[model samples]
Target: MDDLRRIDLNLLLALHALLTEKHVTRAALRLHKSQPAVSHSLAQLREHFNDPLLVRKSGKLELTARGNALLQPLSEALGKLNTLLGTAPFDPLQERRRFRLALSDYAARLVLPDLMRYVRVHAPGFDFAISQASRDAMLAQLADGELDLALGIFPELPQDIQVQTLFEEDFICLADKTAVPDQSGLTLAQWLERPHVMVALRPDANDEIERALAAMGLQRRITVALPHWSAAVELLPDTDLVLTIARRAVGPLRAFRQLRQFPPPLQLPKLAYQQAWHIRKDMDPALTWLRQVMADCCTTGMPSG
Candidate 1:
């Protein structure tokens, strides 16, 4: 084991190449080393292992007993080590890399459209895919490398995960224009009494807006409870009542003349939605670029809801 440390790492590469090719010239070509260099490496490896690793028989190289036993495990270890070292670093525009983001429907409506616009204008070649993951699962995905980023209120993030709050927004009540009396407004008490659409993206805590209603000795008569804002929006036109949602979620709904936004009745603490990623990926260049792009988009590009 002590002598093993003295062996050159490159010789192990040469040995793996030789075993795979079974010919000196072919191994040299594969390794981009001259045949004589490969021969020299073979000699050195034979001396280190104290066995002729290969022998010529029937006009082809045949592995001796030690060589045959080493072939499978050696090949496997070298393949894994090579893959670990050979993982190409990510480059944004030049590389056609795909990033998967885990976000709730509301976040997609609030953030992604503008982020996509930015990507289209700047990093046109980059690809993105989005999937719905509950807060707990999203954090897990980020840690596991299945998700590149998560933009939402992650109150339960693990201590090892890194989170950066991009912006803060408050909740707002949205209703069809015609639903309100005089197309003007309704009191906070009146708003709570009416049927409402609810979003339960955070399974553990009741949304702050709901708590505000409860403090007033009132509770929303929830007509719908959905996981995504997009789903909530789809229900708006069909239902004749108010929808409780984050202010940022209304950015993409400007085209809907039927929906009118009203400030929440009682003051609710602003929702601090953040971008979170695993600390392991913090220094990864491609991921760093992605974080910067998203942070910029959150700060400047989109209109605040």
Candidate 2:
């Protein structure tokens, strides 16, 4: 630890620059120092590590075996340091990064399209993997770095997990146009009588609908239990079923004329969709950009109606 503490931060910066540029002159230019100064720094780095971090081959500088192994890890460490120092500038248009995202199918449907379109045009080469996992599993994934971000209605997480509310929406009733003659408003009694598609995707997810009903000594006849909202909308066209869905789902689900939406008369709590990340990544430039893009997707073009 003493040896680690004695090392100069500037020297490590020079090493990082040298490893990245592979040329003493270019590294010096990157560091805004003279070539001789950078050469002196490299000499000190070799003495400190007791290895030739870079060697010249065919008249061009190349990394030695030890240096080659350090490239990836060194880059990652410096990135985190940059984030910590708050000196990293996020250039989404030029950054090539693939982030892992965990989201419900409904959020994927509502958020991904707009998010992709924004980055697809504004920031080229950005890639994402959208996945679905339970909140506990996803929190574990975030803690372990297997996932970069998660979006949905997650419970209160540990301190290590950071959450940002993207938007809040209320539950609306979806029914086949033909199944309900009155499409304007659905009363509590009407909702109780209809056979419903119970969207119990997870133990905690959307269970509020049932809880609200139970509070008033009522329960809808559950006709089907599916893991995703996509199926519930599909069932509405052919079945006499009512689906209490998030307001955001109304836009895409509205595409199916067979399904029409009505505001349910239950005083259910508003559903808040959020983005979660490990607290460690709160300042990461790329992750911050991704979060902003997601927030924009949730808010744009959905005025009060």
Q: Report how far off residue 68 is in candidate 2 (Å).
A: 38
Residue-wise lDDT of candidate 1 within 164-212, one digit each (tens)? 8988988777787778644446777787678877777553347777677
Q: What is the lDDT of candidate 1?
A: 0.75
**Per-residue lDDT of model 2, residues 1-305, tens digit only:** 69769789889889887876677987887689999999999999999998999999899788888887776677687777776887747677788988899988878888877777678887787888888887788888886668999887766786457788988888888888888868685677877888877665563444778778788887778778877867667777867888887777656653687777888877889978888897556547788877877777778732221
Whole-model Cα lDDT per candidate?
0.75, 0.78
Give Cα distance to truth, residue 147, candidate 1, Å. Answer: 1.6
Top-lDDT structure, candidate number: 2
